[model samples]
Target: MSVNPFPEMDSVSTAEPEPSPFDPIPRGEPVPDWEEARIVWKSTWNIHVYGFATIFLLFTIFSTYRFLKLYSFKAARMSNGYQLKLGLYIAICLFSLLRSLVLFTDAYNSWNIFPPILAKVLWSLAYPCLIGAFTVLLAVLLATTNACHRGKSLASSYKHGIGMGCCLLGYTALVVTADWAVMYSQRSIFLLVLCQVIFIAWGTIVMIGYASIACKITRDLSRTPLNVDRGLLRSFARLLCVCSVIGGICILMKFYAAVSTFSSRSESEDSPQPWRWLAFETTQRAIECSMCLLLILITGRADRKREILVVPKIMCNGITIISGLESGTVLKDIRLKDKQIIH
Candidate 1:
């Protein structure tokens, strides 16, 4: 964030006029080919946003790995339901790592080097992977909410979120496939806006699902103890809500920009460059992934003395054992090198 993500022009324009969906532009005017322009713009934005993002994401990767190792070593000591939720969170982080790697690599790859057909197919597969990763995140929250209100009719809400997320994931594949086809055939801005529409709709649905889950989590948190897990849940809910709200704003801005490109103009320079803000894509993902990784670490941490987490064997070999964090059960086994086994 060397540069301000948002402009310092007072407040964001809420009442600003939006680009009209059915606006009539002259037939002779051609929309600027953003596909070609984006390569350069992306590089520029990457220099600012991705520089910070890459550093943060790398640190998150290291921290997440350390947390996972610590957690797994003592996982058996955790309650079954707590253990299961932790595992789900771990799975989500691992998948996010994979997605980040793929996205980082693909960002710099030139689609022009390969045959157009093959390139198009690979490109089409890319966004769906991103969408699937998001679905996994939503699934984590969905599971959390269900856990908080177990045996209640919360299943319906979780199921609906899952269903909606899965459908959106499927829809990305269609958008990519159709987008490639239209780009090759018609080269129309209409097709471009249509793709944005689908992307926005998909994002909106996912955000709505998250917001709903956050509301459920809020009610549950009020009655829950102020434990480390509860704290992490609070952090998770806050991060999700902030991200969803900001993401919604960005999507609206993008939509306005998408429509701007279709406006009638004598020159490309005169048209609004809606896609300029698209540079934040990588940065946004990095922030999200980093936030989740933080929550995972916080959840796994042994923040209290006498916290009983590790196995009995781990209590051996001169190792000091404390029991109280999770279960009241104390470690019964003890051993020290060059000395009799102490019990």
Candidate 2:
């Protein structure tokens, strides 16, 4: 047997070489399970915020669109008396649009697809818009009551509006500032709790005052019964009250979370209790969910008409019998025609 001197000739055909590690990581396919899971979570929160914001957006959009069309046609035909309410409606429409846009942008970008700097900057920008819209809303509310009086003068109404707006702005600023402290400084959990408590207390006061003034106006208007649609007005008032109460509760929850957080904080660690974080997060989400539901309900077509006053059915020993009024506005779908109301 001849020994093969050229054993090298044993392997002949060529095959493709393996890729190098230096090669770029190929872009991932559609989405992996982990990625998909993340997306689901993200979408859940997006829906939480968007669900409510979208409701407001669509309601305002259709309302504004129809109003503009009707207003144009009426003006052309020279009929249908217009009032300052038109301007107020327009402002509210714009405000709703702004809020929706801000929230939408924030949510969409929260996916981390954006650069960190951009994300932070956008987040900062979005929150201020929310605050601004709230401020503007309070202004509009006060202005609408310009015809009302607390005592001797109407000037007080305007001042009251301005004051309300300022107070909200101030409260918002403080809250945001404290939030910054949490993000920026080594402030103890106790400080954070204190900040939250102060912020919420002031905010609740402002909200209470706001509701009182609003109810007063509604009462005064009802005496003469202005031609303005009471159904819509009452719905809005109910929304404000419900939202304010929820907001107050959310703030209180934050305080509770903060207190728990500090209680668990060690002098050495900058971090607070893990459970506190969890509680805070849960409460925050709950608040968001509540807001979303309310927004959707606002746009829904239902005439709940929660009456605010109730009378006693019977009396008890040493106690006055009392009953409560249902207080909510049922949303109704209405069609509008050129300078005319349609079924």
User: Which candidate's lDDT is highest?
Assistant: 1
**Residue 119 lDDT (model 1):** 40
CA lDDT scores, all candidates in order:
0.47, 0.44
Error at 40, model 2, angstroms: 11
- Which TM-score value belongs to model 2? 0.43
How high is each candidate's TM-score? Answer: 0.49, 0.43
Per-residue lDDT, model 1, residue 276, is 43
Candidate 2: segments with Cα more than 4 A from true spot? 1-132, 147-184, 188-195, 225-237, 260-343
Q: Model 1: residues >4 Å from true position, as ranges? A: 1-46, 49-126, 147-169, 187-194, 225-233, 264-343
RMSD of 1: 16.6
lDDT of 2 by residue, 168-242 (tens): 456556544544444444443344455556555655654674566446534544432223355655665677678
